[model samples]
Target: MKESVNSYVFHHCVTIPTIRKGGPRNNTKTYSTVDDAENHLSPQHFCLPHTLFNRSFLVAVILLELGFGSIPMATSLDTSSTYSGILSSSSPCFVRPSGSGTVYYYQAIQVTVFAWGMHTFSSSSLMDTFSCLYNETFFPDRSSQNLIESDDDSNGAHQFRIRLNLQPGRAYILVVTTFSEIVTGSFQITATGPMQPVLSSAQPITTTASYVLSSSSPEFARPYAYDYNNVPYQAILVTVSMTGMYTFKSSSSIDTSGYLYNEPFNSSDSYRNLIISDDDSGGNLQFQINASLQSSHSYVLVVTPYRKAVTGRFLIEAAGPERLELTTYRHSAGPYSCGNKLTCKAGGLLKIIKSMVISVGCVGLLIGVFCCRPCTNKRKRTLRQQLSLLRQNPISQANSIPLRNVSINTGRTNEIDRPYTISISTVAATYAEQPPPTYEAAVLSSQR
Candidate 1:
């Protein structure tokens, strides 16, 4: 009976009775104890164990199987450590310095317990999606050789596993981020190695990104130091995922200045939205600004020269607790304007010229309609009246003066008293507004 109890506890084998054709019979049947022990122990078995000793042994086995001393089953050493955390909007984000890709929550896991062996890093998502990245350097954008390995998913599961040989007593950064942007949830990470590896929560890494300011960039007025002049500037639209203080510094051969605006940057009204400005604080005529920023909020960072009309190429370095999404921002063009300062000013001059031309044309049109057009009409009417008068009475040029026939004496007078006579027709010319002369009058005038 004691042997039977031991078999059930250790080997999980149970004894059962069987029915035969002859009569009431007892044939021991073995059952696996891996399953529920209560299911295998039937009420009929109580009757089979007729003695009190076997009943006590059976009770002891049942108690052990029911989880009273289950830890005695050869439990191996726990050579792994687990950490749990949640990724939310409050978590620091990881962003690409190139400003392209999904933003990830910069979750860092610092190896606490030091071990001298190859470490296997694995992570599993509890609620939402996540991934794993192993790196030696705290900040990846500064050093490219820090990335040891990365894994998105393992065998189509929301878990990642990476095997890397890590140095003992040295800090190893494990970045647990999500697969998509703004995806937040809970996760679990386990680090297993030859020795126990303890993982603890660590602070977010400092994110640094570089950009340039050139001639073709935007321009704004320096609102600081009572100076309001247009200076060429580069506007960077910064979107931070974590709330903390950020530093911006400029590096260039020319004198550079920095300005931070809380909301949208307006060139015309830059002073109204100014949050902070720095000039020559970074040393060597460069600008350095340190301001507190918030998450889910946007800001404009303007890098310009300290003086007006100064333009050149310059580099901007932004450092923050979490990664910043930096994009080159250009102001939208107006209806009759362009983006660049030169083109926009040219457009304004063109608009002024256009307005002046329109005004001159309107004045000339008024003069022609009211003054010059009436004078032209009066002169045309006078010329028409004179033409009608000429058409009414025609002037006869041949009968302007009266003439009559006459006889003249010549050397041919000795020819039987014959004389040469000349004759002319009688006609009279008339003027406008005067009657024609009678034929008798015309004949009398000619004779006289």
Candidate 2:
């Protein structure tokens, strides 16, 4: 009996017919097109677009079969795999040999394997010289810790190969670049391991969804680095179906910042549950957070502003293994408001009632005391008219006879200072020896 071996070939060959020119001192010959490069270096089978499209179409079909909304692990593995890609001027580049050095163009491909073991990566390029780096990060020159292993075609064979121990489900970056600066061309990578690897471009499939922050949204004391006090923001519950590195970015006119909190986000203690946060890293005063998230766990995405009380519409793009499950997250505890049932404690309620009573009582007393001048003046006018009528009666005024008492002063400061209740006869007798008292003088004497 013969054993059947699984083989999968993934290609990323895009042919740009634009002719490239090399520097004056450069000895490397430049190819005008992808076909010319393939004809010169690689086998005919390696550059076939039909095979590449067919594999992509197969993956798409598999995705649709699984609802096309989730990220699924590769079902099949190959003992050997082949991948092809091109490096143009538009490809991502970094300065070789660190600061103030020559710039080189490179392409980074993420390779993931289901079965862990030793994997070998070898590359063939149409250009005469190229190098490879098995790195943890994209720009290996930036940090030595990121560069796991590196190799160049020291044999002058126009090829490079590297061998490294890989863990299952961990994504390793295979960086391919030229030995010289500013060199661009097409290349192919063939990987062999315990299982056929899933070769995906370093870029993930990102899905952008629109959300909003407005007056009605819940608020929180954003992390101190962002703002001091509470700010209007929207919280999204992020749940991933697969575990992988994910990036969350915010785009809006409101200089936005983002905070990612682990399960059970406690707004009261934001820093404790916080997994990561960012501000203006996405450019244009937006936030970008890249984190490794676990499956079936809860994560809270907080969209706030760089300053307090900022509210507007914003778009959130989540890029990872799969489209994340995002929904508006209103904390089970809700917001802190005196009106909320959970937030209104007994002491708070008492304080609220006390405040209301004090405010209402003071306002009512002020209105009653200072707002009735016209009514008081009308009463005084009636009293004056009564006095004038008494003065008009000559016989009654001359007799100085006792009559019903007349109240004068209306204040209640003291018993004697209150409205006077003296008889008209007494008033006439008291003022008889002096000039007839004016009404104003009589009223002033009553007040005294």
Candidate 3:
């Protein structure tokens, strides 16, 4: 019997011009024109016409006007694993190197890299002191710029820990050695992203998901003299199902910086293309990232010590449906703030508003027509009276008069919009000094 190796990776291969002895695979038809291919009938042909986005926008607007609509966002942690390695350092210094190893993972995300002396029966494990190094260099050497962060204990203990915003499909090296002189020992290394709570509920049986992070929870160590991996912090992830606003905050004692990512932290690209990053909304030293998120996508949220220094365990929260708080902070000062996005709390309002729109909209429209009909008729009558008055005035009735229509904007709420067509002859007759009147009027008056 042959045994299969579980450690080997499997790959897929595609052969070009893949023609079979029979017809094309799956009896697929070939098209000479691009139009034919575009119109090809398939399961994807009868899709929903890509119209949901427009409808969703309209629905969102209506929901807002009705004062109701909120979206849901799901927060979860990345899955992680641990690995083992050995380190030996002789005459260890910043100059002469000792031992280094790398860890690789898929799907870049903000990661918490933990490296400390693993407990073993050997006494060397007790005396073993190690410093962790991290960076993005394909082959990380001590002198490369890829080495952004390194950590050593302040009190000179044999343990080291650091957290970094790491990228996916990238490599990071963790180096361990004695602080100054010769030392060697076995060590354990583990990298973990924030994890989802175990007792998760579809409805979330509790108000929120709770977590406790501290130096003991996952040892975060700062390396000596920034040779590699610099920023050490754990990142939590939250997936949003709808495009809406969300708020993330942490209460840690360390001055904290919170970062929001459209994609999980995998490379330098994650930092450059940030969804939102906030160091401190106020001078309170708390981190907060507030932004609107799109649906059907995962967002990574990282809450870390402000500067990769000593930090105390603190609770953090990611919450939504900020309608109340949102209204309060409409034009507040720089210190106070509400989320800067929309939410799903209005879904209930959407339903009620839709119902009201159906019933009330029809009623209001009918009332508008009924009330406006009389006003319209009254306006026509008023216009006729005004024209009659113009005719009664002798100057307006005169022949050979240059009649000019004039527009007069009325101040009355019920005034008609039709322009008041006052003749130029009327104005001239009213103001000009009559030269004993026009010839015909003069003759008629003399005869009378």
lDDT of 1 at 385: 73
Candidate 3 lDDT at 66 equals: 36
Model 3 Cα lDDT, one tens digit per residue, 317-381: 65442211110012133322213223223444677889998999899999999999898778877
Q: What's every prediction's RMSD, in angstroms?
A: 21.6, 25.7, 34.3
Worst 10 residues of 1 by lDDT: 16-25
Better of 1 and 3 by lDDT: 1
Which candidate achieves the best TM-score against the true structure?
2
TM-score of each: 0.36, 0.38, 0.23
lDDT of each: 0.62, 0.66, 0.43
Candidate 2 lDDT by residue in tens digits, 116-222: 78888888777744545554555333523466776776434867778778888565777777777767789888888888877767755577878987788766677
Clashing pairs in 2: 78-196, 409-419
TM-score of 3: 0.23
- C-alpha-based local distance difference test score of model 2: 0.66
User: Which scores greater on TM-score, model 1 or model 2?
Assistant: 2
* Pairs of residues at least 3 apart in sequence or in different chains that clash in candidate 1: 12-33
Give the lDDT of residue 254 in candidate 3: 66
